[model samples]
Target: MLKKYSATPYVIWSILFIVIPLILIVTYSLSTKNPINGQLVFSFSNYRKFLELKFINVLLKSVTLAFKATIICIILGYPMAMILSKMEAKLQKKLIVLFILPMWMNFLMRTYAWMVILGKNGFINKLLSMVGLNLNLLYTRGAVLLGMVYNFLPFMVLPIFTVLLKIDNNYIEAAEDLGADKLTVFRKIIFPLSMPGLISGITMVFMPAVSTFVISNLLGGGKEVLIGNLIEQQFLVLNNWNFGSALSVILMIFILVFMAFINKFDKDNDDKGGVGLW
Candidate 1:
């Protein structure tokens, strides 16, 4: 009886924060504002309105950019994680600390630092100017992609590294004793075992990359606006809370669908003996 009461605070907190806010968003999403009276009335017009071409294009662009960033993080981070996993314990800990050090700072500050570094008069440009090579690097899609990768690479590395570290050395030795080479052992054993971490890394990198507004705003120089930016504009600039709520609901749906899709892959990989990304 006493233990049951102990959970009361957490349950109340969840209801107050999570459940109430989600309810309000759903209500606003399925509602409309009266132009003259300025009252919210229940309707689906807000969700329907976002189906227009311009908004769809923004959504597609966000997905594409996030997909590309996730792929790049996987490619770069996998090798790093593998190397780190093979390192001495002390060295691995130090390197992992160094890798995640930047994340200790505020997220906004980290994005701002990239803005400074990628700006026209920033360090890279100054170095390029010394060699008489003028190139526009900032305020571009590539800049935004770079910012995402830099900010979220640790998310990719840490999870995969954790999974890799837990793998039994005996498995590798047994495979080698059975005449399997390094690549074969990895392909047959290590890669399969690491699927959970890889999936986790992909989720961590892709979700933030897709919904990020700050990196696109500062690094893409406001030229590239993602779904996140559009949602922000609706809520803050246009004062269209209904539309913003609809957009938020749509974004939430996208995230949930993606997570479900990845979880399917996770389930398939667990059942089979191969890598599963499709």
Candidate 2:
């Protein structure tokens, strides 16, 4: 009876949410525009338009920004995770709360806060002017990158911290017992052990960074458009639902391909065994 109930809910959800919408999106993608009535006609021109240079440029820009954000998160988050893992229990809990507190605030509110700090007349610029320095941050690509990093840092940190905590301390002790230096232990043992978390954190940061349009629009000052922006424009401004749907399909396909690549490359490791280093 329990098994039947669980399976029934899954079937209902799949049909109502996932499967049905996917079918509609696919159907929409393989469609064209009707000049006479300004309606979507059943054809393939939408996909053809999606394959054009302008849309391709937007996709490329989005992917590049996402990659940059993921790298920044790894560089910054790994150290923070390491510090948190090494601290005392009371301090660790406090720090973890501090790290996650920002996420509790509304995302748009946090983003707007950054705008206040980085805008021409904002905090940073005002401080610089007081000291005879000047900087232009608002409506720039750098501002967009900063916003992505600020927003996604918690997602990157939480997964990595979880993995770090699960690591066997015996490994570090054994490495030291065998005269292995701290760097050696970290390079050979700790890093490899944290691969799953690292992979997951990368996915968490990359996917949203690439798909986010609001940050690019508000921080990037409409100059740094991404694939998401293009899709939104297609749907709203151009009134081309078919083209927007096609672009969404392409974006989903791209994410699926990247996930497949990560899974394929990381398939060799099995972390069930708890062997200490050295």
Candidate 3:
């Protein structure tokens, strides 16, 4: 009976930190300042402003870059995860630490370091110039995408690795005994089972990639504006909390909808794998 009260603190914390802050954001997003009386009045003006062409372009660019980064992470991370999951238990632990080492560093510092490496006079360009070749590398959309991939790769890898590890070897063995080839087994069994992890990794990487301002601000040299940068400008530079909150609310909605779509996809994939593989 006493143990039932243990959740009370968590409930209180959620209400205070999560629920209250969300309530405040929603309130601000739906209200605009009245110039005559200097008070907030209910309005859809902020959301309407978001539908403008400039903001729409920013949102599309942010989504496109995020999608590119997420796809790259999947291509790179899935193989790393597969390799890690197949290793000996002792070696797997060591490798996971290695994979996670960079993540321990400050996120801001990691992005700043990228700026140094990608700058015109930085590492890559310097090496290229020595060979009588020079290329513009920094402050481009490619730089932002690279930054996103580097920072968020581990988030994609770890989840998928965990899922692959949890998959029973018996499933693979059964599939092999039933005359299934490696590709067939993977298609019908391994990949389907790993969908949960893949989706989780997507959620982890995409959420941050889509909304990150630091990577774009630093690697993009402020010329490329993402939804996050827009929101930051509204709140910090323009002193327009209402518009910032509105953008945030929309971002939240996008995330929620994406998660719903991923969940449905995962569920549908679950039904696709039957006893034929076994």
Candidate 4:
């Protein structure tokens, strides 16, 4: 009885914060402001408006950029995790801490730091100028992608490292004893076992990349705008609460659907024993 009641505070907190806010967003999304008397009326016009081509293009660009970042993170992070997993346990802990230390700082600050590094007169450009080569490094899609990767790479690496550490060395040894090469053993055993972590990393990296306004705003410089920027403009700048709520609802749905798809795909791959070494 005491344990059950102990959860009451948490339940109340969730209701007050999470549930109520979600309810308000939904209500606002399905309503419209009256043109004549300034009253809110129940309507689907907000959602309907999102079907326009401009909004659809914004959504597509957001997804494409996020996907690119997630892919890059996986490619870079997997090797780093593998290397870390092979290190001495003591050294691994220190290196992991070092990797995570940057994350302890405010993310906004981190993004701003990148602005200094990537700006036209920034460190990279100055270094290149000394070598008699000048490059435009800032306020571009590549710069935004770099920021996303830098911020989220740790999310990818940590999960994969954890999974790799948990894997039994016996599996690899057994494969070797059966005359399998290192590549074969990894393909058959290590890679398959690490799928759960990889999936988690993808989710961690992709979701933030998809919804990020700050990195785009700072690195992309007004030239690049994402769905998140659009939503922010609708709410704070345009004062179209109903439309903003509708966009928020759409973004939430996209995230949910993507997560569901990833979950299903992970399960399917697991059932099939992942990629076959043969």
Candidate 2: residue 7 lDDT (0-100): 100
Give the alpha-carbon lDDT of every model.
Answer: 0.91, 0.86, 0.90, 0.91
TM-score of each: 0.94, 0.93, 0.95, 0.94
Off by over 4 Å in 3: 270-278
* Quality of model 1 by C-alpha lDDT: 0.91
Candidate 1 Cα errors over 4 Å, as ranges:
1-3, 272-278
Residues 107-162, candidate 1: write the lDDT tens digits: 99988988778788987988999998867888999999998999999999998988
Residue 131 shift from truth in candidate 1, angstroms: 2.0
Per-residue CA lDDT of model 4 for 43-138, tens digit only, reads 999988999646989999999999999999999999999999999989989999999999999999999999999888899989999989878888
Worst 10 residues of 3 by lDDT: 269-278
Please report the TM-score between candidate 2 and the true structure. Answer: 0.93
| RMSD of each candidate relative to the true structure | 2.6, 2.8, 2.8, 3.1
lDDT for model 4: 0.91
**How many angstroms is residue 127 displaced in model 3 relative to the true structure, after the best TM-score fit?**
0.9
Q: Rank the candidates by lDDT, best first.
A: 4, 1, 3, 2
Task: For candidate 2, give the lDDT of residue 195.
Answer: 76
Residue 258 accuracy (lDDT) in model 1: 100
Candidate 3 lDDT tens digits, 1-278: 67889989999999999999999999999999998997999999999989964588888889999999999999999989999999999998998888789888999999999888888889988999989887888899999999999999998998898888888899999999999999999888888888878988998999999999999999999998999999999999999999999999999998899889987987787686522111
Q: How far is candidate 1 from the true structure (C-alpha RMSD, Å)?
A: 2.6
